[model samples]
Target: MRSTSRTEAFPAHTPAAAQIFTTVLSHGPLTRSEIAGRTRLSAAAVTKAVRPLIEAGYLVEDADDDARQPSLGRPANPVQVDGGRALFIGVKVTGDELIAVLTDLCCRIRVARHLPLTSRDPGAVLASITALVQELLTEADGFGVAVHGLGIAVSGDVDRAAGVVRYSPFLEWSDVPLAELASLATGLPVTVDNDVRALTVAEQWFGAGVGLSDFAVVTVGAGIGCGLVVHGHVVSGAHGVAGEIGHVAIDPAGPPCHCGNRGCVEAIAADSAIVGRIREVTGIEVADTAEAVDLAHAGNPGAREVYARAGDAIGRGIATVANLLGPERVIISGEGLAAYDLFAEQIREAFAAAAFGSAARCDLQTRPLPFEEWARGAAATAIQSFIRSDTY
Candidate 1:
């Protein structure tokens, strides 16, 4: 961590203040009336909350030249977040690598770095994270601002409230007090959460989920994970594991999952599952998912069949989510999208066949988000913690 003077705490802590600020963040440069209309707060309350924020440099009013867009019938002054007020660090820890980013208060990435991990041990991963965060802290120094908090997004069951990794199959970790350890190592506040949920927060604020209250983000990669936003709140479930679509069983006797279940969505559609199936069906020594995709693209019947089966399993899993939550849209993403061309039609067909009635109308949009976006999601969680005083 860089040696810098302590910065002051955020000025607004009230629920209303957080709501007002987030509203402006997603749709900023809004007049007080617009803020009040969106937040459902009284004009008086909006003024009260906006005062300290503007005075503390967290919010700024647009200048007359830019604010006066007469054609739009907008007011002369609109308040917006001053993104340069502070900085945050976000890290996404995978089994083989770590992705980190330094972001402004608005969750915009300023610097990003990647480091390969040699070990999955908690201590080893913490050291790697510390090294990456230290580099970003140095980058923040050039901007002459403080890095307020650090957010780490990890796979598996994460309890954000406790800041612990209760279980992570990819990392083979359980009961790791990650937040305390990272905070101790880097001397910054820490927030740890499930990787997909962290990503959902970013989407809700600035990505595809910005204006929608009901949507799902399903990630297909080394693992299959889903993040859900229902009625404008990210569902964490009662035990920090809400959207485990990967574990949802579709076939009773297909293959065994690491979670001790047979025929789970993960067992059928995860990258490892696809590669393993391709090797079994073709008797080919395909080493990785990339090779499996290549074989399928090369017109290998067995490899193509494996991808089709995986796509069917994934489609069914998504249908289950739609059946239960009835979301307006489902965003499909992750590295596994590399072979999307091979199975795109299969997924749509299977989903159309399985989804019930109105659920079939749900939009299924595919988005290819890089690992850096996942790290940005982690930063969004850090910003959420800072604004809500959830951790600090």
Candidate 2:
């Protein structure tokens, strides 16, 4: 286990300090006035919050001749977060693989590694995670900065406050105290969250969801997942589980879900679901989702029909989200996008058909994010926990 004896607390603990830091990290190199304007804090407050950060080497000011405002009697030099101030580790666990990355404080991936998982057992997965983190920690030694925190992204009902994996269908796990175990093993403060929500945090601060007050991230792969951002905040719901559109039942007569439900979106659209349906319909003895896609791409009518149905289910599920929350955009992503051509039209058509009047106007964007990006998203959560003073 690594040592936490050298762990340092954030320079400032006030809400404004965290807010200011996040603003710079997201849309940075801004002057004090601009920070105040964007964060809705007074210039005095922004200055107060920025001082300790600058002194701590977390924020650095850069000369900007073009930003000089002589009329205001200020240079308007911009301040930005120092990406090298510290490092972090993020791990994204799938049923069969582990993706881990070493990241700077700005959530930029400095180094990454991928390991195949031979088992989905909690203990086995934890051991794999411990090994990967140790590898990343060794990489961090070259940077001469402490790895402040570690974040683990798992697919399931995760209680961030409790640091537990309440249920993970993909891994067949229940009530696993993943955060506590990971922290104990790696000797770094750990933040455990739903994979989709973790990815949403990264997007909200750095990726597609940036500058948007409301957006949704819909991931299609081994399982379908959704992460929601409303009014600039990622919604975790009162129970710590929200935006589970995959379980939204769209057809009562449809296939059964592992969640013990019928006609759920996941049952119809998840990678495993699609593969199984393709096998049933085409009797091609396909081994996995890749083969299923190949069959569809090769113009197998049965395989194409299966993808069409899955796309419809996914579309209807997205429509459900739009009808309920009315987000500005829906980002569709994940490893499954490799076969997006098979059913892209069906998804759009079904969404357009089911979505309410104005809700149908929501933009649907496709982003093909590899597992490494998902690992980076996990790192973003660690950055978030560090900034909020939740992981010391």
Q: Write the per-residue lDDT of candidate 1 for residues 299-384, one digit (tens) a residue.
A: 99999998999889889999999999999999999999999998888889989999999999999999899999999999999999
TM-score per candidate, chains pooled: 0.96, 0.97
lDDT of 2 by residue, 222-317 (tens): 899999999989998988889999999999999999989899999999999999988889889999888899889899999999999988998999
Give the Å shift of residue 44 in candidate 1. 1.5
Each model's lDDT comes to 0.92, 0.91
Q: What is the lDDT of candidate 2?
A: 0.91
List of clashing residue pairs for candidate 2: none
Q: Which stretches of candidate 1 lie over 4 Å from their true place?
A: 1-6, 65-76
Model 1, position 324, has a per-residue lDDT of: 97
The prediction achieving the highest TM-score against the true structure is: 2
Give the lDDT of residue 107 in candidate 1.
Answer: 95
Range of the 10 consecutive residues with the lowest summed lDDT in candidate 1: 67-76
